[model samples]
Target: MTDELRSAALESKAWPYEEARKLLKRYPDGKPGGAPVLFETGYGPSGLPHIGTFNEVLRTTMVRNAFHTLSDLPTRLIAFSDDMDGLRKVPDNVPNGDMLREHLGKPLTRIPDPFGKFDSFAAHNNAMLRDFLDRYGFDYEFASSTDYYASGRFDDAIRGVLRHWQGVMDVMLPTLRAERRATYSPVLPVSPKSGVVLQVPVEVVDAEAGTIAFQDEGERIVQSALGGLSKLQWKVDWAMRWVALGVDYEMAGKDLIDSVTQSSKIARVLGGRPPEGFNYEMFLDDKGEKISKSKGNGLSIEQWLTYGPEESLAFYIYREPKKAKQLHMGVIPRAVDDYWQFRGNYAGQAVKEKLGNPVHHVHDGKLPDGTLPVTFGLLLNLVGVMGEGATREQVWAYLANYVADATPAAYPELDRLIGHALAYHRDHIAPTLKRRAPAGVEVAALERLDAELAALPEEASAEDIQNIVYEIGKSRFGEEGGFAELRDWFKALYETLLGSSQGPRMGSFIRLYGVANTRALIAEALAAA
Candidate 1:
């Protein structure tokens, strides 16, 4: 390692962004000769791509970006669609047996995108990422395992891996016994809860060509990988592929850490060097749950793109790759708000770096941009609260478009903050339910809130609305504690009426949603009561 790299590793505490940047700079002019530093990622095609999958891409993309821009390295991001892997089970909410029949034994890459615009299964899976990358201004080379297996790219590596297959098994079996309580080849899935294990058998059809067949524990034949003239076992396949592809770094969730560890050992035994980087990231549901496909609790990447801005989503995934955590859907508003705040911080930094000034960009100096330093889910809700005319679709569209634009240069920061604030309102605020009151009682509360809003002057800003609500709150509840009462009352009233206690602040919500429209809603609530 160079002096600069050693310094960065120590000072930055081995952060992926810093480490990746240092890798490029370690070499003169950031060139690894003919060997291109590869930022690699892969995902199974068993279900709709989840938000966590996006994280895998984002973490690596950040590394790739740092190498090219920060370290001035010529690097490439290689996308691997594990479409040749067998399907584990049919995901929930999908059309059942029929869908599985079409996809059974096929690699996820071969599965058709539910949207049907893509040509192959891998294409379908890759397209979700393609859309995300395009939306986020990233460019990558997409490769499919099936294609690589067929193209003879790993011929030399495959032979080496096979020669050391026994050693690979020795390393993997012990780890499996220690961590998972079973020893099986690369494709086996261990039941996390029951500790039960199922061994997947891979049939070696052509040892010379690298073609194989896969079968379940029940001996049911699943998929076949016909070697164009070469094949390796699952463990060997992994190690050889990494070397063959020249992967410099790959990030995965905690679950895959074991597999990668095993693969690393195999890489060493086979006389091929393991990739230089590895990062284990956490998976989070919208509400901080461990996102899982089997439990049917994970949020799809599509859903993420639907509700949140691309930048916030990216930041959420990349913020801390080493920790394992659940992301709850309920708390996404807060997350969005935090991301926006961070964007504002970035804006401040950019200004300081370019124009050399410090100003109230937003959220003071607590959050910054480009570094994924803050959360803005709340701000997204606020934006939703303020934009009465916006729909969830429209809001996401605005965010998607905003992040895509290259102009105004600093627009992403503003866009993220606004997007988070708006999203928070739509997802959390507008859907509130009266927590402590009956429908009839809540209608009365709505009437009271409406009365306060009705008194506000025209052409008001958010602060004006806040002041009006605060005054009404003071009048109704008492001078010292009135604001809380008013705020609580509005929360209940909106929940009863709009189904969310979290709506935009009453005054601003009414104004943006339009006084006439809000009044109409309140009147309806009263009538229903």
Candidate 2:
């Protein structure tokens, strides 16, 4: 690492850098005997992977990258899937509900695949999770709870839990309701007869023997909680994983705060240190409801990708992670445009400023070239004016005129953006557009603006055109009201001429859309009035 970058990283307050600093503090000498610092992210393969799942891995990767800049210590990220978890209920979004319902209470990895593809339901979802992560080129190893337990990887941890049974109960009981506290057990034994994971009261016959007695079909059965015979409860299992894997860092949503606390205490009982992490606020749907994988209420990763580039999505995830943000289709255009703006600013930034720039983190300090010649908002506006029949050829024609020598071959990013804008316009913007006839003062203002445009020089800049627009609005509306009237004047232009309540800046729009076309739009609005 360069001295300048190392200096900046040491002082950087970006969330990823802050997280990396936590690891530095944890292992001042960088893990004794040169063991790689282990980072983990947990996934429940009960439902399909969603945007939230993507956020965890992506954010964790960002932190891992930041840690590399700060330290030369080797690091590893494990995407751990708790597929051994019992199927509590059928998810609403999956197929073959009857098949899934029949398999309820069984371990997810044992349940028959609802999609008829993978061997089990968890297998299907785990593959989906891996594919999702791989699609984004995330570097990590995949770990399965079922495999870990079946392969004896978690045997020692399970034995440790057996030895500290009371300690585990003490940590967990207070967090549960009275009804739950009565029956909760650190060990969940899989029924030999039924093959279902049974959550029943257990009596520790002997901690040394790793033996537990529990009721099964009115019979008291003695079982060894080892070698896939049993798995720990969610909280206890979390602690066991930490002890077994020696996890250094992990993070979770704010909703898991209590779970993390309870698990941290359990980790202490299991003779392990809890991983360093922060609780990021959850993503909410358009209605401000917390998004759920089962309910599938928010925008999916697929949906977001369809409307914007992955870097834009990464940029959104990188910003204000602790602050709650609404995840919806409406946020896409701005995210796409904002990503490029940040990338554009990255070139001119100092090293310290670069450390703070989100684009730097989004691309792991390797930023791509080119600021978008036109904003996404302007592209959407162009699509709005061109109507549903607008083609890529048609859009590129206008783009070529506005930006000399521009083409799809030269600007691949803009080409992708054009496709995204077209889709967004067709699905979202088109149906909502409702042009109104100009009334009274608006009609005269529209007429005057049209005449002014007709007399403008061919080479008039956007700023020059903007000045003319500002003067027109100020002259027409300044006397009656100040800023409010000026805002209303712009609103009037949007509502009457563009059929929208909001739009791109008038000068930029006119320059790209051609002044003649804008004048024709003004004439149409005035004639209707």
Candidate 3:
């Protein structure tokens, strides 16, 4: 990849970490043209996919995209689902116990899809990315553990695993020191007649129906069939799976960093024929408790999409997958717009400065103006003013209007800019409003409010009303309040009209929306009062 391309990746939140760059240059064609590079990633099917899921795919996609942009020496990206990993516990809204018991101890590929539309659990999880990637334009192959194992890829690897079982344990010894993390157990195949693995202190027993079992020191029993494997534990299985499949690069959250490292050691012992490279991405929402399917506290990618463009969600995940980032509700719409705008500017600068992705020359789309972007908040406010409903075109119009006046001369494509702004607005602003109304006032009670204010010793003139509110807000919110109160008020009005409390500001909002329109809404409130 070109320097500009490398920098473009960095700007979009892809790290040019040492290992990644080395793989970029070498694995595809660096030394006597290495094996066709294979990039892999996966997701757990336990919950709705979140922005973090995008991070995993987007990062891998960037690498895959970069390679595709290059000479195209046969690079492929593969994604999978760990459906067979174990349901462990029920996810919210999903069935529990025996409902999922049918999938217990099997690879996700074997479990039936909970939704029933897909053939198996692996298919369901695979479908999420297939939909997402198709929308985002990433190139990748979809893989499933059940399919791989069933296809006979694991047979030879299983034999190799049996050959190097002890060395695998030695490599993982250092990681098992901590109790919370001491979960790995290496897999070793059985000798046909002896029915026992060579090294580990495991017992072999034969039960009914040609079934075989292996018991570890902890008394954990692993069972298999006469001709197949049901006994390889998860950790060792994770490592050998990669080696068997010839994965060259993969990125995962920090939570799995230790486990993957231990697995790498097993790969080394098994013949050192492992995926040549790996990247340790940071976990998002790391500060907050994990968003297990059990907790139901975390946001999902679909939830993020409801607010804005998929691109912004992609940019956000791209920008901060490895970092501990938070996705508060209503943030993606704005972020999507912003990332596109930033990406546009970054690309422009890179072309001018000769620094980021060269493909940016051909890649269109950029970020929008800040604050003025056509956010969901602003759109809701416009809809609130309309008293009927707003269409996508109307939202786009407001965005264009806002961008035309607010953007500097340096930006010439105001309409396009507005599109970006609206994109961000949709991504970041919540469709639902968060209104914190004044202690006693309500839009419906405005008549009583007016009478109450009018009956006071002196009524506030328009100037006084503006000054009073502005001054009070300024005192509390500082310089930002000069306009923020208007924004908050819109939020309040949105909440009042539509049960959402966030939107455009007062003055500019009214100015752009028109006073006649404002008076109409105010009159309705007064009449109700």
Candidate 4:
């Protein structure tokens, strides 16, 4: 580790460590009844699981890992799915849309699976949540709302909330609009006859008896607070989940900060302490709008894993998690590169240094041994040079010339990185790598630049070649206004060489692509120009 980073590590205001300290203070000795420190992250299974949802769980896990370093108390993280909640509308992506539409207002567990793979839509999404988590080897207990409610696991918590219904009302009612306040009830009864969650006024709440009496389509139904007879409102459910699970800590997106505050009030009313948590800013899409699963604008879990390694996504979740970061296909390469720069160097670092790096938290203490042989952006450029769908053998060929003896067997990640780079190039890079005949001035400069490459030393290092490329590119045009003129010349070189207005750091790229290959590429581009 660098002396500067090691020095910063001593006093780094890292979030994970800060959150860990807060979590230890909350538990005092983990939690009541000898239960381990419980950290829960909730998911609304109304749509396919997205990267945003995964971020919630992964970020919580990061904290959990951080907490382990602070104390020896056994801890558990729950990946809770609100699957029992009614499916108000069909997701556009699911199959059998008409079948799902008919089940509107019915619990997701009651509706048939749109894909016919699971018993119900909720089960399928829950399975997906589990599968993704398991695929990444997350250590978390899966808690399904359907199972929790149906099995009467939350029966006591449900009854407690009802007993303190007025307190819950005071916390929730103020947040609702005037029209909403008139009809709002924390509990929404599931009609036995119609099998739909009825949104109606509560005629009577027999809190002591744990029953709710409400009118549903002219029928007066008295439903038990136990056995999934009723589901709590969003805020109420959040509170109840914390109370029932005995959550000591958790984290959420900023959009839920208001709801978490309201839930904290409801939790106190329900006679349990609220979990300690931080509300992070939302992830913006490419358009700078908040990413939504319903809107289908955010990166899907499949698309993210398809184009990049899971660790890259982990790096994204750990990187500036509190900031409102932009997530898009364009953001993958930097994340991929970050894996090497940060986590790659984590193993040998001092304890204080590791504290500053989230790699320890992201990997849960068992950090990977080494880094990637090359940067992902360089690989993307090479993929473009190698053409789309380039096989592993072919990629390794260029890679061997670039980085000696580079093999997938030696670098385990390279096996996946190889295919992922090709796909990423085709999907995200190739379009930008579109060929164009350089403009009149650009053509003349690059033609001169090509001739300079031929005069380079045969044994020149990447740095040496890079310096030569820089000088050639910068001075191709007369140096007028120094920095801006150099920038314009570099811009011309990018357009001529990369066929794009921007590119990877040039010197390293020229070195990695091999001086010979880079020279040939420049000559070919100039000839075409």
Candidate 5:
């Protein structure tokens, strides 16, 4: 690392840098001969991987990348899947509900695949998680709870939980209500007969021997806690995984705050330190309710990518992670535009400023060259004006006219964005359009704007057209009224002419759409009135 970059990274206040600093403080001397810092992210394979899964790994990677700049220590990210977890309830979103219903209380790895692929339900979901991570080219290792348990990789940690059974219970019991406390045990034994992961309480017969006695179907049963014979409850399981895998860092959603606290205490009981991490607020749906994998209320990873670039999705995940943001179709266009805006600003930024810039983190310090000539918002408006049947060829024709030398080869990002804008307009914008006829002062303003636009030269710049529109609005409305009147004038233009309450800058839109076309649009609005 350059001395300049190292110095700037140490002072950067970006969240990723802040998180990296926490790790640096933990290992001031850099991990004894440069052992790689281990970063972990947990996945419950009860359902298919969703946007939340993508967000956690992406944010964790940003911090991991930040740490690479601050310290020379190598890093390893492990995406752990808790597939040994029992299927408590059928997920609402998946297919073959009847098949999953029959497998409740069994380990997820033992349940039949609902999708008719892979060996088990957990296997199917784990493959999806891997594919999703691989699609984004994330650097990480994959670990499965069932594989670890069955292969004896987790034997030491499992035995540690056995030795500290009471200690683990003491930390967990208080948090549960009276009804739950009565039946709660740190150890959950999988029934040898029924193959169900029994949640009933167990009596520890021998800690050193790893033997536990529990009743099953009115029959006495003795089982060893080691290997795949048993598994810890989720809280204890989480702490055990941290200890077993030597995880240095991990993060979770805000809803897991209490769970983190309870698990941290259990980590100490198992003679290990809890991993350093933070709790980010959860994503909400359009209605402002917390998004759920089961309910499937918000945009999925697949859905977001269909309408926006992957970098935009990464940009969205990188910004203000602590602050809750709504995940929906409406947020996609702005995210795409904001990502390009930051990327465009990256070239001129100083090292210190670049460290704080989100694009640096989004691209892992290598900012993509070239700027998007057209903003995504303007493309959406272009679609709005061109109507629903607009094809890529038609859009490209207009773009080629507005921007000489433009082509799919020269501006590939814009080409992809054009497709995205068409999809977005078809699904979201077209359904919500509410064009109205100009009324009162709006009619006169529209006539004057149209007349002025007609007289302008074909080479009139966006700035020149903007000045004319501004002067007309000021002469007719701004001088006689406050800011509200001028604002409403623009709002009227958007509603009556564009069929939306908000739109791209009028001058930019006019230049791109052709002044003649815009004049015809204004005349159409006037005729409607």
Candidate 6:
């Protein structure tokens, strides 16, 4: 960044840099002893990754970006997945539930791939997670729970947990309900008989010997502390992952705050401090409930990408991290609005507000190189009114009429928006489209409007067209009912032409779509009416 941008970032508290500053304070002297600054974002590979997964990772990237601008230290992010977790239940979205159930209690890495492609279900999901993150060009290291356990890389932390079992239990047991506390054990053993990780009673604990004897199949059995023979329970495992990777920071949804609290305590007992962290609010679905994989109600990563660009999703995350936010399809337009609003204000904002806008952090202090030639909301509405089979060039031609220079090179964002908007129209808005035919006097009024439009100058501004539309409303409908009557007339016009009662400003739409084309649309609306 230039001196001015840097100065702005220094004073801003709205962005996530406050957390970054805290991390730098903890790792003073610039990563002392050449250890890279580590930030970890974890996933449970029980289901396909979703928007919530991206939200956490992307938000962490923003903080990591801010950290980089504030310091010259080497830093790394670890996209960790707990693939070694037991397949407690089959995910709702994956193909075969019975097949997954057949492997219940087995570690995810040990379960067969239901799809017949990857080696195992866990491997399939891990690949998907990596591919998604890689597609976004995220800079990070990837780690698997299976790799850490089988290779014994987590041995030190595992050993520490076994030795400090009592302390770990003390920290975790209080967080659980009554019955769980009576039989709580920091370790869960892999049953030799069933080849499954089992939640059995611990008959004996030998922290000194690095072993635990767990009851399995009506018999007591001993298992090694590490080497894939045994693993800590989720709470303890979460803590050990931090220690094993030397993670300096991690963030989780508000839903995981209790787990975080217990894990942090376990980390302290295991001879490592829990990383500094943040508990971001969860993304709710359209119904205002927390979006969950089990419910299958929330939008997925692919769906978001299908409707809008990745930067739009990033902007959604930037709006607010601590407070709860909704991530359904309905919020996309508003996010795009914020994106335009933030970028438009960057040049004139005081350094603090400019640097504070999530756009700067979203791009890692570098502003985006392109602009959306039109509001995505307007573009989507235009696509809706354009009806079916509208090609890219057709939309581009309309945009160019008003923009004069709406070429792909000048407005790549607009090009993508136009394409996605059409897809969104077909997939979401078209089936219920309302094409009302004008009734009685409305027919003559539309005819007059079409004539007025046809008589317009060779060129006219959006406002000019809007004024004509307003005049049509007043003359035909008599607007003595205040703004309400004008709004109703426009609503009727939108319903008649676009199949919706609300849409982009008619004046703007007409100008962008061309006066001749709009006149034809008015004729079509009259015919349909």
Best by lDDT: 2
On TM-score, the stronger of 2 and 4 is 2
Where does candidate 1 have its weakest 10-residue lDDT segment?
A: 354-363
TM-score of predicted structure 4: 0.93
lDDT of 2 at 143: 97
TM-score winner between 1 and 6, please give it: 6
- C-alpha displacement of 526 in model 3, angstroms? 8.1
Model 1 CA deviation exceeding 4 Å by range: 1-16, 21-34, 96-120, 127-132, 176-231, 286-289, 293-296, 324-336, 350-465, 471-499, 510-529
CA lDDT scores, all candidates in order: 0.55, 0.91, 0.53, 0.80, 0.89, 0.81
Q: Write the per-residue lDDT of candidate 6 for residues 63-149, one digit (tens) a residue.
A: 888887777788899998888889888788878889999999899899988877899998988888888899889998898888988
Cα deviation of 81, candidate 1, in Å = 1.6
Prediction 5 TM-score vs. true: 0.97
- How do the residues 97-165 of candidate 4 rate in per-residue lDDT, one tens digit apiece? 998888999998899988999898888888988888998888999988989888989888888887887
Q: After superposition, how far is residue 116 of candidate 5 from its true place, in Å?
A: 1.4
Kindly list the per-residue Cα lDDT of model 3 for residues 298-389, writing each as its tens digit. 56666655555565666665553445666655455466546545554553464424223222321322233333244344444565454334
Report the candidate with higher lDDT, 1 versus 5. Answer: 5
For model 5, how does the per-residue alpha-carbon lDDT over 11-56 read when each residue is reduced to its tens digit? 9999999999999999998766667899999999888778887899
Tell me how far the alpha carbon of residue 410 in candidate 2 is from the true structure, in angstroms, after superposition. Answer: 1.9
Candidate 2 lDDT trough over 10 residues, lowest sum:
476-485
Per residue, candidate 1 scores C-alpha lDDT tens digits across 401-472 of 223442224454544445445554556555553323335334444566678667756666656766765654
- Residue 247 CA displacement from its true place in model 3, Å: 2.0
Please give the lDDT score at residue 331 for candidate 6.
82
Question: Cα deviation of 216 in candidate 2 (Å)?
Answer: 1.9
